[model samples]
Target: MTSASLGMAHTSSQAAILDVIRAAGTISRVELTRATGLTGATISTVVRRLINEGLVLEVGRAESTGGKPRMLLQLDPTARFAIGVHLDHAGITYVVSNLGGAIVTRWRQPGAGSDSPAEVVARIVREIGGMIARTGIDRSRVLGLGVVSPGPITAAVGMVLTPPSMESWTEYPLAEALEDGVGVPVLLDNDATASAVGEYWAGGIEPTSAFAALYMGTGIGAGVLVNGTVYRGASSNSGEIGHICVDIDGPPCWCGSRGCVEILAGPAAVVTAARAAGLDVGPAERSVAESFAAVARAALRGEPTAAAILQRSARYLAVAAHTLANIMDLDLVVLTGPSFALAGSLYLPAVEDLLSTAFFARQSHPVRVTISTNASDSAAVGAAALVLQSELAPRQSGARLQAELGPEPVPAQGRTSVVGSLG
Candidate 1:
């Protein structure tokens, strides 16, 4: 075999082994051999390489099966670190996590309201430095920076396409700017996809055959995970549940669609409905997070109008969930993001009820819908998970894989629907 082929084969094998070890929590070399279908000698060689790289460590001895007790191998959670940045108009959330996707440090700041691209990039670089210093993590041990933003992105170009929620960030070179500024590799993915990955790594949703993460912020989107990896459609913008038409002639969305889930059920839509019902949603200048919380609070307090508005939003979200479950045949739906922090109590049972009753394969396989306990920071944590995924798993789906391995590495604006994903 050729030298290049040999190198790629070794890398792939090593990565696969590391992933198994990670998923297993603590495993012995014999168990790895059994799981990987690799020879004992090959497992030994790869495990040795990983140990030398500081990626894996020998924790202790496992129970003896027959011969001498085998040594247990596990990932060195502190061996490397990654940073995740969630960029939105309301605010920016930064998370620094170890190799095992444990948060070591975190910071939250006002987002790029009207700042230039350069200014946003500079702020990210400075904060990244601060996080490393505060956590006492050596700069060289940091893997890379992963930035999650409202999407309609061209991941290959590392650009954030014009997501309506953030008008000032049209076609911005976010990944490149951050990579150059921070002096580390940068990966830019939509918040939904990152959230799904985070759910898998940190939220204990791994080994699942298929599931979807519904990220509800100012807008809503989904991250489809089929076989433990994100299903990024043609343009790396697959999961725009927000733009799905739930009502034929309901409300006009900013995406030029009628009755999109975003227009009918997103935080903005809920707040608007609350306002129309004479509920106090505070001033328009306040952040989406705050206004959404206010509406949720009013509903929780049993205000009839506010409760009715929230019910309507929940119904629309159920439409989205039903649609996704029928099409993707998903086994699970995780409702997450900042908007769900307060309103999830309202959305959970409503959507779950709809799915149980209306899903196409409900009789054959019941689809489970649950709310993320980490709704407020799942995206940021997921962004950190993205770095872990990129390094360890290197997703074979999405424009990212195509960009890295396809014939040409140019960005393509491949659209899957009337509008692309919004976060």
Candidate 2:
């Protein structure tokens, strides 16, 4: 952020070094050299540049092996900052995270509801301004903003593939609109992928870990991370787990698939089942998110009907999770998103049980399942990490984070194109 005093790393080698130090928590120069398989001279040179740039700090010292104590180094948590916002029909979440992926500020706001794209954009701009002012962090320290939502983001057609409750946003030039209003670079991503990166960036998962972030908001999706990089499949649509068919003869899905996890076990399905079971989930006028939350709360409160419906959905979800794990051979699967925040207690065990018992790799290495520490705000936190990742850790996936939002949606008449590729 302080380019004159703390120039940003410009090479993959430098990014790799920063990532290693951050992931290690603290490592000596010798360890970095060994870990990276780089020459001592190269490690020294890169670490020196990082130290000079204020990205790395020489911490105390490590035990010596019949020699002088080795100096240890670490990422400076306060060195830089980034913003993340998760846009969903349930609620909008905002978070500010430092270089170490520690969230410094967070808040929530009403979902888009029936608001127009322009109005929502204005509110997002206003909310970010207030949030930054409240945190009191220097603007110069912030790398930029990252925004996540459901996909496939057919920006070319000006709409989310599965439209969030904010149907009016179907034709919005979201990235360009936000950047213009916020006066900062804005990157876009799907919530599931953002959650995956958020977990990796937070250093909870190992740097080379292979994991999937199973996110459930208004809809369900998953994001996979291989090593530390997002395993974006061809066309950046690697984690559309919601479309995985769990039952061949079940209900139809908008994705043109019969018995997809989305149609059979997503929040809408859960809520619909609840109502059909003669349970009072919520008011008819309430949002689908609200209805689903009612069911979750009731299930937690020992309502037999609600629990039955929710557990059924959880089982369907687990079926999908099992399928995904088998295909990816993942080491971990994290349940995250606003919906999970409300009923993860019910879903966690279902997913865990299935993976532990049915995962193909169970005989070799047991798969792990856990809820995201920032579950309710996982997407937003990940979005914030997007800025940090783009600038510091970059990516081995070829495209920089800022340019990885699939395609730039065609902007409305009189407006610039949505931010992607061209940006």
RMSD per prediction, one decimal? 6.1, 5.3
Q: Per-residue lDDT of 1-423 in model 2, one digit per residue for the tens?
A: 122111122236776677678778999988877676666887899888888878899989998788899999998988888899988766888999988999998999997777777888899999999998998888867777888888766333335565536566765678777877887776777788888888888877875567899999878899898767677776566788899887789887877778989888899999999999998877888888889999999999999999999899999899889988999898899999889999999999999999988999899998899998888889999889877777776654622532334343222222332122211
Q: Report the CA-based lDDT of candidate 2 relative to the real structure.
A: 0.79
Q: Tens digit of lDDT per residue, candidate 1, span 322-364?
A: 8988999998999999988778989998899999888999889
For this target, which candidate reaches the highest TM-score against the unseen true structure?
Answer: 1
Clashing pairs in 1: 151-423
Best candidate according to lDDT: 2
Q: Over all chains combined, what TM-score does candidate 2 have?
A: 0.89
Worst 10 residues of 1 by lDDT: 414-423
Cα lDDT of all candidates, in order? 0.77, 0.79
